[model samples]
Target chain A: MPNCRTVVPFSGTPEQEQKLREVIARYKGTQGPLMPILHEAQDIYGYLPEEVQATISEELDIPLAEIYGVSTFYSRFSLNPKGEVKVSVCLGTACYVKGAADVLAEVEAQLGCKAGSVTSDGKFSIDADRCVGACGLAPIMIVNGDVYGHMTVDRVAGILDSYRGEVE
Target chain B: MSENMINLKIDGVSVEVPAGSTVLQAALAAGVRIPTLCYMKDANELGSCRICVVEIKGGRGLAAACVYPAADGMEVFTNTEKVRASRRQTLELILSNHRMECPTCERNGDCELRRLAADMGIDSIRYEVEDLEPQLDESAPHLVRDNSKCILCRRCVAVCRKNQQVGVISAADRGFATHIESAFGRGLGEVSCVYCGQCVAACPTGALTLKRSIDAVRAAIDDPSKHVVVVPAPAVRVGLGDRFGMPVGESVQGKMVAALRRLGFDKVFDVDWAADVTIMEEGTELVGRIKAGEKMPMFTSCCPGWIKYMEHYHADMLDNLSSCRSPQQMMGGLVKTYYAEREGIAPEDIVVVSIMPCTAKKFEVSREEQRLENGCMPVDYSLTTRELSDMIAGAGIMFGLLPDEAFDPVLGDSTGAAVIFGASGGVMEAALRTAAVVLAGDDADVPLVFEDVRGMEGVKEAEYEVGGVKLRTCTVSGLANAEKVIRAMEAGEAAYDFIEVMACPGGCVNGAGQPMHSPFERMMTDVKGERAAGLYALDDSMPRRRSHENPEVKALYAEYLGEPCGHKAHHILHTEYVPRDTYNV
Candidate 1:
């Protein structure tokens, strides 16, 4: 009964499709190619849509169920498109013990979007990562590529305000 | 012992098994019991569920008996203190997350997990299940999926991908969120699921089960205005007895008829009669196609699973399929049309229910093409063998002691060719038996038995010269074998004049709607072979061995329909197909 929490509309362009097909053709015959092809497709499309999964299923002759299974198994692969400003809160053991869940909750309230989904305006997204390997900076939050160590609930809105003004 | 045998000591008993055998196999060889939850012989061996964990001497911890190989001088202890605790702990953890509604579960009495828990004497669950919110999926016509009862064994997934080769269902997501689902969380009906129900059969718990029609059938029977007529498919005759405490491979045709009569049906008939009629129409079509050289191979359309698979996967070769309705649908159409007229009952007033060994028949009965011109389906309710057995038990009818009763004379009589339609090569063999005589002009010598296409092999191929016509034929059970044949034909490596495909292994006798057996019994016993043998035995006992020889079928053709494949017969007994997308959602 596990289902997709949020599914963004598939907006892959013709150029992106052509690039995906090329990537599929390059790795069609390689042993265990679904993983590599999925990774590349995710990179090209920013996320794996049902339409993109169907294309891969047809080109590789693999069942779409299997492709979807592999895509969902790895946390690296995203099913929904990431927003322009991606916010990731590490919920690994170290981060959780130091109150990362509060940070994640604040982000969700500020962005008006749940974890693993984009905001209504498609400008902000939040995800709970397992571990970012920064235990020394427990309770860490990453915005785009920039990491904030020892993050607090009160500081979450201030950091988002700084990016909100820049994006608008 | 053979040179390749491995020496092992299981529970202090010296056992010698094949080198490639696992610790479970070695223990079984030495008469040791090792309970398993996620192990289905030749189908699933994930060892994900550690219910089969056993202690090995000189090893650090308990190892899974299903995957742990038996080596020379290996000491395997199946029931040691450590093994017992580990298995008990594993079961407890699985049960912690699993929905414990055994009283109302479909597989209450036959559940493997429940049986194991009782055997291990686990009275209570220590941990509470975090709200998983496992949803019930009743999207498909044939199967219902309840993730609440799923133990994440993946047996259904393995069987779907490996045994059936359909691969419609798979384990999506990971960890606690992992659940079996179709692509993109689409419903099974929304996807290209053929509704074969093999996954239902592979499920160890109440996670998967056929969509029941027992209540609808009961309602139709209770309505005084309606006249309900029941027709059981050929395979049900041989497979239904398995639920009645009868021995496996026992054909209780008379008892089945008696039970249906006791179930308040207005008439109890046999689908085998319609199977004979199918041979007449399909045989004529096959001969015409061969004579005109229209298509290379004419695939049989009796199996709804195979039909849907063709429609989904091999739509381009749809023309290659014989347009004849399956025996069940043929019988239903005839009951609503010919029998209804004969009895002076309106087609709308008469309810046609098919008792089948297949779950796919439920979907088949709901098809738009199967509906009459009056906008009513020929078959009202298609009930599985298991459903019928449950209804019989629920009605307080002692099936074992019921007197053997013959089917009503209206649509009861059939020939030997009709009975064998339960097996894999049955339809092909039945067609050949009649086609030989049709091509050679009836009174000419023809072979009654086509031994080449008989037995329980996944795929069988044969070449025969009938009436100076050299015909290459292929008979396949299991969609995987069908896929292989199609791929071979596409590659120009193989050619055939006729092909018969049954999606279930060993044909309808091993259908998903038939009796459920434990993994041990399934691995040890040849259920498919035994059930098919029962049909073949019944076929051998019949005096008339061919379809054309069925007196009732010939009487119908002479009385109403002018001839086989005639315009009127075509209107009722034939149908068309359309291509379907695999991912319709």
Candidate 2:
């Protein structure tokens, strides 16, 4: 029954602390407002780390368990930090039937990381996804939210190269 | 009839529909069927199919009529030249990498893709079909996955991850070669999947299908040396009628039993009998633990999906699960051991077949630990509701002409309470029926119905003051809700004296192994709810609705077993869950 203030202590720059306070004020005394605040914070900061979750929990006077529950419940929210470039591979049924496995393998090899893992250099974060509904363009990959259609194993390196030059 | 309505023009025809209706609804009201593949009503509206695209005047581009809202003064064209071309092209693109073996496919005539192509008059593919070899994943016992015919509509993924809350398979790679795969490309059997088969129900194509056990059952029947016995699950009575084009919730128990007899089975029994026995065993276990103050929250073990979830993710809590095998498994064990001895048949010669409403029953039948005597698996084959329907049709039996008959006297009699086990919260209610009687010491007939734990809510809870002792109980349907309940319990946010969990929402009636329906079509009717009502109504009409009233179950105790928790009953009807870390990723 302990509140979020008991779980998280105040630890951030004065400006960052003020920004957290402003975010908390927007959702103060509102029903189920923690999810929306977390969403907005993740939208601004690219991810919801433990520190950020704790800060939000303390500011909103909610339990950290409740905050963690909200984050894990929804598919849109992610806990880990995302790299500058987000690489998402399509694993929709159509693409899977068409050989998305090869595309995934090639991308994993080139990036030197598995799906749902971020690159050591912090340049790219790779992840596989459910259908984005572009089955007509089977074996599709999306990098930084830009859809790449009809991808092949040979074409994955080029797609990664294009993102490498542009990202960071 | 004085409600306000909206008038809209679709494909040059004027139609009137409700104000909040979508353009798809408006068009349907005009008798204009807009072609669609991935727009199953409220179940799936991801608009991933792109086949329902219709040209809307003043709109940016072709819009999916299913999800796009209908506004006043809007002009909609259902089958414009551009619309037809776009739909045809989209289908052609889907076919480019698809395996076109429609003649031999299971869903040959009933397939949505084939029907759409025929409706669109697509005779040949314009693009070169990719040479991506098809993958036939037979790792799971109850379901088969063929990725070649997949269109990636993601209806299956949406239902599994969002609706069922079991993330077994997901979209894995990006563009042109994108495919749905199990986590880390591991076999589905290795994952924490409940095997609820919601993905099978959500799939629009033949990619996901119930693994038919008909051949194995048929082989058993044909073998003169084997005595094949059949046990029909509680939900099968209500669902089997749908295969005969009967209205949702029709009780076809008589027909099902008669059909099994005609199919050359030596004996046709009811899982309901074992369900009663399960209540006896599980109910006693609950009381013993409660009396001894051991394992405060005893979870129901009838649901194979929930058991698999515990085995994979929550292995540490395995001891908390009720040690009763599902009614299907219980029936199988009894038929092979007790019945085999009584009938003078060798244990190996007695083949037990279960006709179930779930796909997960297949996994339960073949579980390594399920073998009872001399390493012999109790249930030989588990046929899904759909597979059973196919077998009935394959035998050329005139179902409509068949008279409704009763199940055999031995193990065939069941109570109305046992029948409700097909739907969500059923196990909890069934257990409560016997628990109340046992707690009263001489069976209290008062308060037969536990209304709090009934309904379609994801999670439900109630406190029962039975015999002056407060018992906190919780029931969760759907794996996601179960996860929430477990997390709450682990975090000390919630406490329950007992819990019942089913992986599929609405229980076996809405199982993954049931028939697949378009979401748009389901939006037009309350199919799942109606099916559930059918089971509940059947329960109400039965004269023997309490588990303890089952004469066969009483005989089970008198003949073979001394008491519910007797050593003999525990050896056969009960088992344990094992922890596994098979998530390769």
Candidate 3:
């Protein structure tokens, strides 16, 4: 499966709302459409807010609880808005064995944010991953899709500084 | 042997089963026990657990007996070494991820997983257990969810989605991270949960249990200045003996009363008496609606689960719901006001505790609309039959040995119609007994039993004659069925003067807070049917079969209140509804 771009929150503009409506219109009647609709919805809106899910639920006639269930069940979906610089520390089995927990702690301390949460300014967000499939490069971390292999706890500070003005 | 009957052999024992029957069904019929975790017989047969796996001759791998069909001359080995090994591995995998908090768990002795583990003689886990971050959800009033105790059987999810049509919970995440939760990973109390606790009843482990009110009752009971009056629902008696070693459908109302008396309740009353009063107010409301031609189909407002479902999904039909409080709430209101005033005790001094066949009652009493002006809760603490049974045993009372005793006189008298409120179509039947008489007036001889509405069909519609007017009624139990009836009503395909809806299938007899059916009990007996029949038997044995004929209700109205649905009854027994968004978070 190709990587789906899951960043870029909705500006709450009319165009984004229309795009969301079109996504719901395209997938409403398909068999088991909630997951797909949610996937597309997350793409259209960056993350599923209560309002986005409510729109899909209204269009598809699916219960909101069910849509929420499908949305939460898949780790790929995010309920909160993503920060400009999305930092993910791979806690996959290989990474954990190679001191990924220390790397995660370093990332959180430097970015001042925990997994699944955005920083106060919303410029930096952090999360953990299962595997980036780069197990050979154990203890790998990603900042805005830029992979840093063999990451040490000490090297985390340098990585954040590298991405510091790259937000624009 | 019929032509459709297929012959099968299980461990060299020959058995004949219907052609379409599953191997599990045939084995069960042959008195063979195969353990199951995810399988809930007909309700949920997902076959995900793999605990009920059996070796099929000439098959490549082990077959899940729950879903595998039995073939003619099929040889199945259930207790073989390979089958046992596979079952053990499956259980071990489940156990590895499970929290293993059996000692302090809520469902310690009553859990299916704990029983299976003990039966298999699992001394120690062979696999590495997952170190999980414990999550506690007390969002809803009646239920608590512990993801650590969950085995991902999906039983609760299936029951919630398929049976109730209120899928407030679903299988979230995947693999080791998989656990059941509400949409968007929000707390259940934050969502549109109906607080039905069907998931709690369907759970095989302590993953789900009630938000208990035992401690509050104990505190009230220990307070010398306070008078805690207890009222048990009609269905409580039929299923109370289930947790004890007694047979299913055992009549333990008398012993239940005796047990409550010994538990230090100042007054042990019957909620059925309030059920009779419900019939008076609700029946009067039906008569008024029929006569006024307002709100074409007046729905019964008895089931809190159904009411919450309406607030979320069918808020437009709020006008159709009868404005009367449920029997539990009605009894609560009366106990704090009428009963307290009669006994010369201050309403504040009276702590009303209700023992019910529903977990939703706990949520119901706490509802803002059900509280009085001075902030005194009508029913202070609501306990399920299961909770009450546990309390009785905890107090060292020998339930079976206790002699039969009657309830205290003030609020104890109940007729047959009141008692049948525990079963599906019962409220309709009970309401009909009084409504017809009120509507018929001179020609008020209605039949004691309305057989058309008295069965286990998902939705039953019946019409009866009252004087020259015809009264159409629809009775439904499960919320799924309730949806169908509402849809039909919307489409103008059916119309009714009155409609009764019970959130649990088979009504309170199969309530979520009632004694649950273990997988063994599910196989052994028709738990709902047996309990419903016991209620009907009690209904038959009573001399007065009509709610209006209850002498106590008659005297209460004659003495305290002027008439049913009068100014005083409206203030004490009526309620309002508000529309809410399905997803709050």
Give the best candidate by lDDT.
1
| Candidate 3: tens digits of C-alpha lDDT, residues B414-511 | 99998889999999999988877777674246566799999777799888886667988899999988988888878989888889999998899889
By lDDT rank, best first, the candidates go: 1, 3, 2
Q: What order do candidates take by DockQ, descending?
A: 1, 3, 2
Off by over 4 Å in 1: A1-6, A102-114, A119-121, A131-168, B131-134
Model 2 CA deviation exceeding 4 Å by range = A1-168, B1-22, B25-33, B41-43, B442-445
Local error of candidate 1 at residue B398 (angstroms): 1.0
Pick the winner on TM-score between candidates 1 and 2.
1
| Complex DockQ per candidate | 0.55, 0.04, 0.44
lDDT of 3: 0.86
Grade the docking of candidate 2: incorrect
CAPRI grade of model 1: medium
lDDT per residue as tens, model 2, B1-585:
326687778877877788888888888888887877877665577777788899888888899988888866688987789998999899999888778788888877468888888889999889988876768888877677889988888787777766655556666544654667663345666565678888887777788877787787898899998888888898887888877888877778888888888888888889988888888888889999999988778999988888887876788899899888999999998888878778788888788888888988988898878788656798988888788888888899878778887887777888888888888878888888777866776665557888898888889999987765678999888888898899999999999989988888877877766655566556666666778788888888888777887888888789988888899998898897877752431
Give model 1's TM-score for chain A to 2 decimal places: 0.81
DockQ for model 1?
0.55
